[model samples]
Every structure is written in structure tokens, then in C-alpha cells.
Target: MAIVTTIRRDAVTLPAAELGPDNPLPPLRPLDEMHRIEDRDKDDLPRDMARQIGYEPLRSLLPARVRDGYGRERAPRELDALVIENDRLRATVLPGLGGRVASLFHKPTGRELLYRNPVFQPACFALNGAWFSGGIEWNIGATGHTTLSCSPLHAARVTAPDGGEMLRLWEWERLRDLPFQVDLWLPEGSDFLYVGVRIRNPHDRPVPLYWWSNIAVPEECRVLAPAEEAYHFGYERRLRRVPVPSYDGIDRTYPAHGVHPADYFYEVPDGRRRWIAALDEDGEGLVQTSTDVLRGRKLFVWGTGTGGRRWQRWLTEPGTGGYCEIQAGLARTQLEHVRLEAESDVAWLEAYGPLSAEREGEWPGVVRAAEERLEACLPRERVEDAYAAWRPCADTEPDEVLAVGSGWGALEVLRTGDKLPGTPFEEVTLGDAQVPWLELLRSGSFPEPRRVGPPGETLVAPHWRDMLETAPARPLTEYHLGVAQWHAGDRAQAVRSWERALPLAPSQWPLLRCLAVADQEAGHHERAADRYAEAFDDLCRERRDDGETWTSVTAALGREALDALLAVGRTEDARSVWYRLHPVTRERGRFRLTEARLLLAEGDREAARAVFDDGFEVADLREGAGAIDELWARITDEPLPAHYDFRMRPAM
Candidate 1:
């Protein structure tokens, strides 16, 4: 019933249109300029100027005209790519695109399971700024795609002892300065593709990290998972569970019904054999099963609204089709930082491919068919044997294996030091630096203020300074340095350090607030307003323009930015900023109260009263209820009541 077009894996190439001047990929930021931008302090600029500076490096720097119609007339050409295949499945890897699997085809069905973007269209989506929207983006070291997501990776094709070809892709995560590698193994006569990854923390200190496997699928698809409950990631890091697929008057499952888009983190109930799929209405899709190493799965849907469609267009070309992400995480959930010990390593195995289905909407039949195919071709037993045959780390043997069982999947080593008493695996040897750093992190003894002598003689330890100097130039390091400098009474240097750090870790509201407060304390009200405005923009981006209101440190900063702007007599700027904040922050009561106050300041009592009536609707959600009353009393020209604190705080 379905027409199929078979694409030869060998013939596929980077389309000529994608390579020419018209469709120019973002020119790589020069190393020196990148470093310079990384180290520059951005807190002093106005809000718009600061954003431009923050986002410019992430763009192609070409005029809009040049980038708009860049690849419209180009043709496909053969490129030097890594093609791995078997009798039933084929995958093409592009070493240039962070070794992403550019094309994955189910040979029998001739269906391209993974969404392959026709061009290397880098956009401002990733946390580190530049990101592409196709293929399986290997995200490690952070929540979003790593800084190198748009860059090339070190790749090599090697033959396993069993004579199977393996494509190895590796890159050093510049942000965390960690080494990570993913090995793609497609055994002969198999339809499923096995992926094995190892991430190593080569430092002597414990480092916080995250790992996510982001696989893109067609937009008009449903995410299938064996999840009974789903956690909705909300503003201010709020996570609450709702029934799977739908809850709280919201249908989270795709082909989403509501206007508000959703990002759901599903906790895989079956620890032994967890799997997830992205299938169409007819049950045709790709199924991914991972060993117990990957504990969490996430679904990101941008919905079919105008804004969502526009964002999808920005990510790819118009009519090229939009895609959603079915992601897997190493930790319980993304943004939940896991501490990796020094000189330590973690590895996991996963397999994915097309599911065979006989009828429309037959979820069970599709899953059964996929399992049968997996069993017939690359069974769990075969996977374990293959993984055990080729050990990943040459210098050491796995002392402890973390896996479900013999036939569940490949064994992974999550922890190395001591083997469980009844466990089957051997104890892994660890580097000498591992235990101390682990202990330090566990005891919360990292870079704390030290008492050098008697009372009031406290100062940041010299070792913290030493670590700051030698650590990778990352936001975390800069933050620690700023804290140390601030406590050491070097406020100006601390502000500068935090300013440099803010752009690197834009989502950190506390850091931004700290810089803002420092400027406010130093009598730089305009600079303080800029810092708060920048923080507000970061929060807006993090919330993805959907204005479901929740209170967080960033939300607090948004309120402060408004007050600071008004304090400096920048009424127009305050009004402009408030409009941008209102849609995303959605603090209806707070926005109304602010609007009323601004109107009253401009001698508009009737308008202020009208706003006050609207504010009363959501008064219960307002944090500064007393402040609202005070504003109301003032607009009515009434006398102030007994001592009242108008200082605002986040409604916890």
C-alpha cells in the first residue's frame, strides 16, 4: 500500500546547494575570537546590546540576504562519509557534523527512520548557542547539545575482532574538558544498530556532568514508551508528574491538542529492559532499547502553533518538514547533574531501528514485531557476547558491571571501586585521585571559605584560587572565582568575573542576580538594569516562549529588572522590557500591578484603576500582595498605613 524509494547509502552526499555560498553554513568562529568573546564582560552593556554580543558569535555573521536563500539551487554530490551497513539496515555518518548519523535507512521498508536535514543549518537553539536540527545529536557534558555539536569530531573506522566494522566518533567536551566517544557497531546480517559510548573525566577533581542521546524524528509522530507517569519540566526547575500521555487538562502525547507545547521526562518503569519508540499513526517507526545504563527518556514537542512552526522553520528550511526529539539520559532526568569522579569513566550500550507493524494504530503489534525482529537478528544474548568480546578501556577491566542480567543487554560499568557482595562482576581498579575527589564532593567540602586565624579572619582558601587558575575556562570555574573574589572583598573583580561567567552559563539566574546586585550596590543602576534584563531574556529562552508562570530565581530577576529600569527613569525601556517579560513570565497579577504603578506615575488614575481590577483576578498568585495594596492606596491618593515592607521576594 505504501510507495517506497530506496536510497543507496553509498550514493548519498552533502547536497551541492548546502555547500555553496548561497546556503552557507555558519562560518566557524575563529579560536582566538571565541576565546576573546568568552572572556569579555558583558554586564555593562544595555539589554539589547548585550544580547547581540552574546548571540553574534553563534550566528553565521553573514548578512540576512546572503543566508536567506543560500542553498536553494544546489544538487547532491558524493562526499567522504562513514557508511556502515548490514543486509537490512544502513547508516551514513558525517564526520564533519560532530559525527552525527546523517542518514539511517531501514533497507526493507526504504524508510528513513532518522530525520536527515538537507543542510548543515546551524541555529541558535543549543545551550552553547550553535546547534543543528537533524540526525542523532550526541549530547554529553551538559543538558543541551555540547559546545561541539556543530563542529567536526575525530572519527575512525575500525574492524572488531569478530570482523565487524565499527565507526568510532570522539570529541573533547571543551566546556567540561572531558573526553567522550561513541562507537557504532552494525554486525553482519543484523537490522539493529548497536551504539556504545564511553565518557571519561580525565581530571583529578570530581566534575558535574550530564549525558543525553537526542534522536530526531518526523514531527507528525507519536512517542511510544512504557511510562505510566510523566514529569513535566517547568519554569524555575519545577518538575511535577502527570498521568502518561495526558493529565491536568493537557494532552501531552503528540499530535498534542493544546496550544502550549510540552517537554516530558518519562521514567522508564522496567529497569531491566527499557525501550522507547517514535511511531506514526500506522505504527511504523523506530524503536530504541537501551541497557540499564540509560535510566531516563524525554520527549520534546514544539507543537503545531504559529510560533512553534516558526521556530521549526528557523531550525531547518521551510517545507523540509519539522522534527521532534526522543531523548535518553544517563541520569534520572536532564539538568540533574551527576558527579563524575576523577580519572573515571562511564559507558552504556543502545540499539535502535525500524519497527515492523501490520496494521494502523496497532501499538502492541508493532512492539511485538520489533521484539521478534530484534530476537531473530541481534538478540540480547548476542549483544552481551559481542560487548564482552571487545572491552572498551584497554588499560583496565570492568571491576563492576551494572546491567539487568545475562539476556537483558550489554553490561556497563557505572561505578568502579568496589564490587557488590553478591554481584557477578569483578571489582574495578580506580586511579589514585578518584576516592579523595569523590569524598570531597560527597562531603560538600569543595572550595569553601576558610578561617585563616581568629574570628572575622575568613577568606577563600588559596587552593581554590589555584584550582580556578588551572581549571578549564568554563562558567563554573568563573563562578567559583567570582564568589571567592567577592568574599575576599574584591567586589569589582568579582563583578567582572561573574560578568564573563554569565554568557557562558546564561541559564544561571543566581549568577546574573549576583552581578546585578553588585552593580546596584556600586551605584551603577543602569548596569544593574541591564544585568536583570539579560537574566529575563535567558529565562524567556529557557521557558521556550510558553508563558506558564512559575516562580524561580530568574523570575525574581525579571521583577528586579523592571524596578531597576524604572529607578533610572527609563520608563519606556521598562515598558518595553515588561511587554517581552509578560508573555513568557505570565505573572499576570505582578504584571498588572507593575503596569498600574507605571500608569499612575504618568498621571493616569482611571487607567491604573482599570489595570488594578485586572490584577485583582490573579491576586492570590501575586508575591507582593501588600505592595499591590500600597500601590492601590497611592493611586487612590490615600494615606500610607503603619510600617510595611514593600520588598518583593519569590513566592516559594
Candidate 2:
């Protein structure tokens, strides 16, 4: 059995001989709100400076410390005395060792030591000076002299040779405590060492301390958090949707880590958290930080392009590489649900001898022993307790009609096992803007709405498609009729339903859009082109009145519709429709670029250049610019090797 200790308060005071000037230090604050690092705004420098520096825009106006005639960025000056120190511990001070050592301490040391040096840190204890080049600071230090109580928390107490709650400072009895005061007396050739921290809590009052340390990484490193899905967001712009898929374990190189061309947002709902650990094949161990505790109330992760820390050793090559910082904490906006309990806190943490640190044998054994001790200290039930208890979004009564938001509704119902109420998709309310209502319905949490009537007779084709006789207020009815007719191979009837919808609901884009597809399927290619052109015109006119245009939907689908028009040799119609897309949008150039290729096929090289140039000026469309340039090269009679084998990338 482990040593049994008692709880106490107002215990015997330290002897006059042992009490130093720095003894009886100030108490540590609770770590309840420590995860608010993101809430603090970074200093804003001039815009010109920001553009000039690209991303590392923070001006280093603080005077550099001149050390031995060389200027060095300022950081903690002493560490050996201000913290637990060891020769092996000294090796980890290189500003990036926290990624290696992520664990908790299990037991408290019982003895205090009288110091000869009287400093917490050794002179050589500072880690490698500069690593993260993106204006983020990464440094560690210990105070040279500060009073540290044996036990700041009164949860447990130890009795020793001196008396109750008093720690003996004498040398060790045998092999233990080898590093503190007697490294020279150890057996020859033995490198093993032990440092101790004496702790006692004699008071009945609870002890708390907000213990935290940070590991920074380069601003460019990609961060991946486990979410049901992900969306890219540029902080400077209103959020623009980008095409990134949830990581499916099918591709190797295009794995979650490599797909990041821009910064992304990973949405972890309330009562859930994500662990975004970095992985570098280059020696730099992953930079893992959390905004809040994983398995806690709420956890968010962010990686800004501006400034961060880097690990030199983790570089792919000797002098070139990127850094990834994983910040573990709660989110601010869209995450007000996450909060900390008033009294709960992280009492102690250990950071050293990284998970990958390889020693002959004893190192791992020591770590295992330390972990086992920590596991034994906490009760099994509370081992994984979150920073705050989970709570439902709103109050509920038995059998009350309730509609859960699509994205998180399923999870909420799953946990509570509440009988969910049904709503028409059009009637459903979704609080979150990130996920669509259709997606939530498809995720298996909600019941699909059944139309009021069923078993209607299918309409037959021809008869001049009499369905166009119906009025437009019945778009839902016509839409259903159109789908049924299409499945029945009555293309004419489907086209009539679309034609009826366009006249009744002249502004509805979907009706004309469907008619275009119906026209193509019915072998009326010319008619299809006309319908697409009409729909594109409606969308452009609607945007003038409503500031919100269907950019995401149209930007993605319009190019597809135009490509179909071109496939049937209707290039003129394709060009007219392509010209309507906003030049600044992400999909602006794809259709026009497609047209350029079509012009090149017709031997019109100069016309294709003018068309490509119009849409290629947008910076976001640069991805498609390469394809246009290649086609231009081929059209201009530039000699290029045929049968080019682009480096293959495997993807699911």
C-alpha cells in the first residue's frame, strides 16, 4: 500500500534556521479561466509593415539584451533555481521539449533541501535561444531565488524527523536522491539522478494553483482537429467556403496533414473537445496545444498566419522547416457554452523526457513509475472529469415539442434519449450557420418528413406535355412531379413541370435550372442552352436587390451546367452563361478557362488569351491559372514534351 498521509491546517511553522527571505511565497491563482489565450488580442502594427513582413509583422521594438557583445531576444534569465532542475532536465530546455513530455506527476516529495547555490536555475539552463521565426516567443525559465512552500494545498501532510509537517533537509540514506546534493558521491560511471519537491498541506482549506506552460510552433504548420467536418475561414474576410473533406483513412500523402492550403476551422460542439497533435517526419516532434482540456466542456484550436513558435530540431532539413502549435483551450465566440468550475484546477504537471526520448533503459521505467503514482492519486470516477460538467442547451419538459439544430441535435438527443419532435425542413430552425439543415437530416438523427399524399399516378410523355398548363405557386408540387416524370422516362412531362414553374414563380432559380437539365436529357440541346442562360440572368438580377446571392451554390454548380452546354457543341451559350459569374469568386475562372480551351481547339489562340486574362486576375483563382497557362502554351506552338507524367498523388 502507498504511504497514508493526513490532511491538516495551521501546522507547526518552519524552524527559524530553515526559513529564508523568500520562504512562504504568495499563493497561486486557480486555473479556471486560463484557457482564454485567444480572447487576448495581439498588438496591431501598421498595415504597410504587416504587408512588408508578410506574416511575421510584430515589430521587435523591445531593446535586445546584449550578451557577450551579441544581441539576443529577451526571455527568462534564470531557470535552474526557479524550477525543478536536473542535468537531464537541462537538456530539454531547448524551447520545444514540452511536446516530448506531456504527462502528470503522481506523488509528492517529502524532503526539502538547503541550497549551497541558493538559486533555482543553473547559469547554463536556458534552452536554445531562437527557434520560432514567425514572431511568436518560445522560452522557458526558473527563478534564481524565490520562496516555495513545501505544500500550498492542505489536502495532505507529511511527518518527518523534525516533527509534524516538517521536512528533513539532510543527505539521502542510500541510492535515492542522487542528483540534488550528492552527484559526485554516486558510484563511478552512473548517470542516474533524482531531484525532489517537498510538499505538505496541514490546513483544512483546499489548495489550488494555475500551473501552465506553453510550446510554440511556426505560423505555417497545419493543424488538424477531429471534427465531424471542417470548413476553412480566413479571419480577414467574411468566411469563404473551401473544398476540404473530412479525413477519410484512404489516402496517404493527401492525408489530413497535407491538404491544408489555407487556415481552417474545426467545430467541436459543447461538451466535446478535439486533440490536434502535430506530426513532422522531420525530427521536430508535433506541436500539441489545446485551447481547453480535451474531454472537457469545450475545446477549440486555432493557428494564425502571423506569429508562432518553431522547433529547430524538428526541421525537415538542418536549416529549413515549418512549425505547428497545438493550443488546448476553450473558444471565445460561438463557444460561450464552455466554462470552468469555480474551484477545479490542474494541481501539478510534468514536462520533460518526451514520449520519444530514448534512453538506455531506466528512463522509461522512471516515467512509468511516475504515471502509475499519478493514476493512483486520483479516484477512478474523477480521473477523466471535465473542467466543467456537461449541460443541455435548454430546459425541457416531458413530451414537449422540441427541435434540435441539425449539426448538434443528433448528439444532444443521443445523450439525453429525449423523444424528438418533427418539423418540415422549411419550418426547422437551425442556430448554427456552419452546417446545412439538409446535412443534419441525412445524419440519421431526424426522421424524414413524409409528404401528405402518396401513390399518385405517374404522368405520361407527349400530349405536348400538358403539365405546363399548371400554375407556378405549386413549385413543391411541380418539383415532385418533375422528379417522378424524369424517373418514368417522360422527359417531356418533366420539362413541362419546369416550364410551368418558371412562369408561376418567375424568380425561382431552381425551376429554370431543372428545366435546363430536362431539356438536355430530352435531346433538345439548343433549348437547354436557352434555359441555362435564362436562369443565370435571373440570378444576376436577384443579386442586385438582395445583398446575399447564392454564391456558394451558384459558384459550384454554374460551371457544371456550362460544361454540359459546351459538351453538346453549344459554345456560344456556354460563354454567355460563364460571363455572368463574379470575377472575384473562387469559381470565376473555371468556366471561362474551360471556354479558353474550347477556343484553342478551334485555332483561336488570341481570343482565348483575352478570355483567360479577364478571370485570371483574381488572386484566389490562381489555382486554375496554371491550367489555363498550360493550354495557352500548347495553343501558341510552344514545344513541350508529350506524355507528361505529373507526380502521382493517391487519394480516396
Candidate 3:
């Protein structure tokens, strides 16, 4: 049958909470930043591998601000979706949600190749925040889910490799200041969906790059890759080599066989085809294979543990069958970041489709049959050739615009005058957040706001920072420059910049928070607490609109402030800040944890115990967080409940 591809507009209405608005306050330092520099030497990794692991630590997320502004409160909302279909498959892409392939349905088989998350629940999972679970997600730029996980992407209908209509999703990744595009299309009568990805570094210097295609598959499936030994990274913050299928008497290849959440990065040997799959007992499931450049493949299991299950429930709704992630990336592990030389780019093609394991033996026979099926359906040569065919199409201008993403990309283009041919970040997309930065680029001066409010987003790219440094010496200029410096790992300089801005700032809270972070890092706990207290006070007293937007601000800032105050034995002060928080905010799992800490600090052990007894779930729990266990120990001698246990490592 002749191949025919078509792309059309569609809608998917799910119970999704509004992303509200981007938090104006830049997150100075966050907890996950500490994990970026894991003990590579301790892991006994090769020196070359260890160097890549610690290549470039993500010091601060300045250029892109924190996105913890969303809440659990949700309502039915229709989201813009783009559907691309061929004879054998149909892919429904959510252009509004990072161009996520919301559904990949195999027509003949009537099977969904990816985990179709039932609801849209925003959790603090992304690097910025507000990441939802589901479908095939394109993760780029450093570790964790991309900041764009919950944000929109620039999508358009473009010509495909086989003269079919293709859907193209493009975005300028803010973290690495790189432009990338994803081209998705289904060939004529082909069961596999082809995705071509490209990441470009348009700078004079080399940049650290990370890319991963995260496909969520049903938890019941057994994941198989091309390697026997895998790098195991558990919540204990340790990475060690271990056998694949069986680890500690459990066939961990089956997602639920593990006892806790962990990562198994398959060690695909050199010259071997890169692929990963999640199939059932009969060997029927999805298989993802990519060209050589995209080398790494992984299995991320949430495990069968109570905490893991609880987290699963927290992300969406209960009874929505559990899931585990099968991902492929540009490095051996997500911890390592490869260097993309100046003016260079990395591109590859990936094919995702169903596999039928016909052979009857054990692990080896099952995987071999699946591999043969994969080769029959979509040969490796065809994939490589399809990539060659798509290269030119990747640069083809979109025929029609389907959706628009953040204008941060356009602003960067304005500042640099760099012409991106296919992935154009049009100036028309420029919005409120990019306005001030626009002025800085055009007029060579960082303009102050008409009235005092939270600081807008910061720009930490070298070029943007240089502009800020040369711009007029206003407090606002110094403030953002300090943020850029802090992001660049210049702590002392960032402190000086914030201190200079403190005297004449329009909003003292933003500057105060940054300074407090510096103070805390310097072991000036008392000073840090005082600064945090003042910052929270400034925010509470400031004139604000009555909405969840500001409510998010207070909750975020208040939590940071409360932690600081409690660190210095200021339980009363912490309590006051906690009370000033919105009732809804106070009820959140994180804040509830804060409340327990407050009660304990004030010598009210019983009250603290009750806080835990109330039963709460921290939806945004860190991957390897031991806080719950530690806090539980502080309150009583009783064993921690299963639901609260997220310890990823075996007890020492």
C-alpha cells in the first residue's frame, strides 16, 4: 500500500490544573543541585567516565526561573493537540505540553504503545517544576525533565521525508541556550513512528548537552536492552554496576520486581544497536530503537514499594495502572553531559513501535525474537536512511503554524541576531516576561519596573550577563547580573552584586532571598535566618492581587523563609510565617512537613507526631529524599510506615 501521512488539529480535554503563571522569583539554590555532583570516584567509574559525570554542575537555574506556581486543584480544560496519522498508526501530540506524544495508538493491534496517563497532574518533577506524567516526553538540556515538560512548544505542519505531512516541534532550550527540534511522522503503511531530533549550539564556546526520550510504559512489562551489566543508581545517591535481568534474586527487568525506586542504565556495548523495550510475558509491547549517536538506554522503575505506589497515585489518579520509564539519551547515563562544540549540532533518528516476541525460550530467546521482529518491521538501515531523508526536511520551513511556546527563545535571537532557519522563534511570541529583557537588548539599559513587584525571570547566558554588566548601574541591573553570576558559580561576586542592589532595590525580598542563600552557604545560619525573615515580611506586606498567582509566591517564599527561621531556633518566627501562608498552601504536604519541624523545634513532640499521623503525601518528594525517615525518627521510636518510606538504598 502506498504511504500517506496527514496532520490535523485536535483537542484533548483532561482534568488539568492551570500552570497559573511562571513564578517571578528566581530559585537561587535548590535541593537537587546537591545531587548533580554525586561521588563519581566513589562509584569506581573510569576516570574518563567520572570526568563526564562531574563535567558541569548545574549551580543555579537563574535564566529560567522556578515554576512551582501550580497546585493540585484541577478542572476540565481543553488542550490544543496535533494529530499525525498514517495507515498503521496514529500519534496524538500535545503541542501545548512540550509537544508530548500524548497517545501513540497502533491501529491494527488496537494497542497504546506508550503509557496513556489518565489525568494531567502537575508535580514538582521538572527542573523548574510542574511536570506531568504520561506519553513520550522529550527531555533535553542537563538532568531531570526539561523545564519545557509542562510548557508549550512551537509546533507546525511541515513536509515529511516521504512526501507526507509531518508535525514539527521546536524550542530554544533555555538551560543550555541551545535550539532543538523534534520531527514526528509515520511512514506509509509503516507501524513504527519516526522521530528525528537535532540540538544546535549557536555559541562561540562549547556547551554541555543532555537529551533523553522518556517513554512511560506499563509497570507490568519486562524491560530488555542490549547489555548484561547496568549502572544502578538508587535513592541512596550511589551508582554501581550490577547484573541486568536478575539483581539480588529479583528479575528487576520487570518494573514491579524491585522494592524501591531506582535507575538501571543499560551498558550497551560499542558497535551494538541501541534499543530498549517493555514487553509482556508473551513478548508483546513497545520497542524504541535509535541511531548510534543517541547511545544510552535506561529503565526507571518506581517499584512496588508503598512510597512508590503512593507517588504514583499522587501524580495522577488511583487505579490508573502504574508505569515505569524506558528512556534513551545522548550519554551512557543521564548524570553525564557531553560537550557540543561551538557552532555544532547533534542529530539522530528514533523509531518506536510494537514488537512480537515469537520465540519461546528464556530472557535471551525472548529478546532475540523481539530484535528479529524489530529488524523485520523497521530495519536498522531504513532507520539510518530515513534519518538522512529527514535531515533536509528538518530544515524545511513549516507550512503552517500550529502553536506558540515561550518567547524566551525569540528574546535570545533578538539579543544575538542569530538566524535559526527551521526553528524560528518569532518576535510576535514575546510576552510580559520578556519585555524588560527586550528593553535591555535594544536600548542597552536594564529598565526598572513602574511599580515594585516580584523580579521577573533572569538571564544567565554569557552574552546576556555581559549586557547586564555594561548596562546602567541600576539596582535592577545589579540584581539580575548577580543572578547570572551566581548561576555561573561566582558566589562571592554574586554576593557583592546582591549587596550593592540591596540598598536601592525596588523589591527587597528578591534580593534578600538571594543574599540569604549566600549566607546559609557561608555557615552564617543566624544571618541567613534574619534575611529570610525580612524577605518574607516584605512579601507579606507588599500590595498584591488576590489570586493563586501571588498565593504561589507566598507559599514558595514562605516555605524557604520558615526553613531558615527554624534552622536558627526561631520556632515562634517560623510559626508566624507559617500562619501568614494561605490556608490551602499550609495544607500541602511540604508545608505540613514544615509544620512538623516547627512543632518539634518548639519542644512539642506530641504535636509533631500528630502532623505525621494526619497522613500526608509530599507530591514533590526528591528522588532520594530521606527527610521523611529522619523526621519520623525524630518524632518517635516506632518503625516508619511503608507509605512514608522512600529509601532507595538497602539499610547499611
Clashes of each: 8, 36, 1
For model 1, how does the per-residue alpha-carbon lDDT over 342-404 read when each residue is reduced to its tens digit?
A: 878777787878864432344445445655655664566766665565453222322322111
Q: Record all residue pairs in model 1 with backbone atoms less than 3 Å apart, i.e. clashing.
A: 16-75, 17-74, 22-70, 23-70, 23-71, 399-426, 399-427, 399-428
Window of ten residues with lowest summed lDDT in model 3: 33-42
Each model's lDDT comes to: 0.56, 0.29, 0.85
lDDT for predicted candidate 1 compared with the true structure: 0.56
Relative to the unseen true structure, what is the Cα RMSD of model 3?
Answer: 2.0
Query: Residues 396-480, candidate 3, lDDT per residue (tens digit)?
Result: 9999999998898899888789898889999999999899989988899999989766777788888889999999989989999
Across 190-259, the per-residue lDDT of candidate 2 in tens digits comes to 1211111211221223321111123333323222334433333222222222232323442111222332
Prediction 2 TM-score vs. true:
0.32
RMSD for each of the candidates: 17.1, 25.1, 2.0
Q: How do all models score by TM-score? A: 0.55, 0.32, 0.95
Instruction: Looking at model 2, report the run of 10 residues with the lowest lDDT sum.
Output: 175-184
Best by TM-score: 3
